[model samples]
Target: MAPVSLGVLASGRGSNLQSIIDACRRGDIKAEVKVVISDRQDAYALKRAEKHGIDAYYINIKDYQDKAAYETKIVELLRRYNVQLVCLAGYMRLVGPTVLNAFPWRIMNIHPSLLPSFPGLHAQKQALDCGVKVSGCTVHFVDEGMDSGPIILQACVPVYDDDTEDSLAERILEQEHKIYPRAVGLFAEGKLIVRGKKVFIREAGND
Candidate 1:
């Protein structure tokens, strides 16, 4: 079978993007990153993609008139790559209707906290402030709302009493690296079925 083609959007160092790239290369995930797009020209994610010989693009958000226009251009880029899936790795922008409507449940994102919890930025600090004993990462299908999508896979990390924001985040990031690829792998294998707010991962070859 042909590998699932992925269009990855990122805005920072792209550690999760690196994890996905590594996963694909190791055959741990039945997918290939077709292209990478970043809103910032200096984002390291673009460099990561280029290093791997994948086409990388930098779209200037300031040039677009509105969020819709910005997302429309992104959608155009993704379509050009014939991307089968969209992954957001540390992509700071909230997804707009244009991209959401284009991909539907085909989009995935890795959030730093066990979502429905610390959702937006500084999630680790949010978790630490709330005194939660456990903090983790969630891989979920992207929707119109912010990190409100149905969950696919999650890995928990114990929050130690002495854990600072950086410490908790570091542990959670490790889990994120593990699960994002697994969730994408499930999608590649046709095992992910979304019904309302729930995502069901079916047995391999049984679906």
Candidate 2:
């Protein structure tokens, strides 16, 4: 079967993007990153895409007049690349319904903390502030809400007493790098099923 073609949105270093790219290269995932887009001009994901010979572009939200206009413009870019899957890799922008309505369940995102616990920014700090012993990362299907979507997979990492927010985030980020690619591979292989608010992962023997 042909690999699922991806269009990833990013805003920063794109460590997750590199993971996806590596997964595809190693044949650990049956997917192709077709294009990468970022709102930030200096985003390293663009350079990484260029190094990988993938199409890359930038569309500034500031240049756009409104959020709706910005989202519409992004949707057009995704369409231009024939993107079948949309991955949000550290994209800071809150997407309007224009793109969400366009992709529906086809979009996936990796959130910093276990969702339904900390849904907004500074999630690692939220976990530390709330004094939770357990904190982790989540890969979920993107909905219109802030991190309120059907979860695909979650890997738990314990929080320690001596850990600061930055340290805890670093631990969670390691787990994020592990699972995000797996989640995308599962989706590409037709092994992940979403029913209502629940997610089903097929036993793929450590895939």
Per-residue CA lDDT of model 2 for 75-185, tens digit only, reads: 999998888899999999877799999998899999988888899899999998899999999999998889999999999999999999889999999999999999999
Residue runs of model 1 more than 4 Å from their true location after superposition: none
- Looking at model 2, which ten-residue stretch has the lowest summed lDDT? 198-207
lDDT of 1 by residue, 1-207 (tens): 999999999999999999999999999999999999999899999999999999999999899898898999999999999999999999999998899999999999999988889988999999988999998999999998889999999999999999998888888889999999999999999999999999998995676
TM-score for each candidate, following the candidate numbering: 0.98, 0.95
- After superposition, the stretches of candidate 2 with alpha carbons farther than 4 Å from their true spots are 202-207
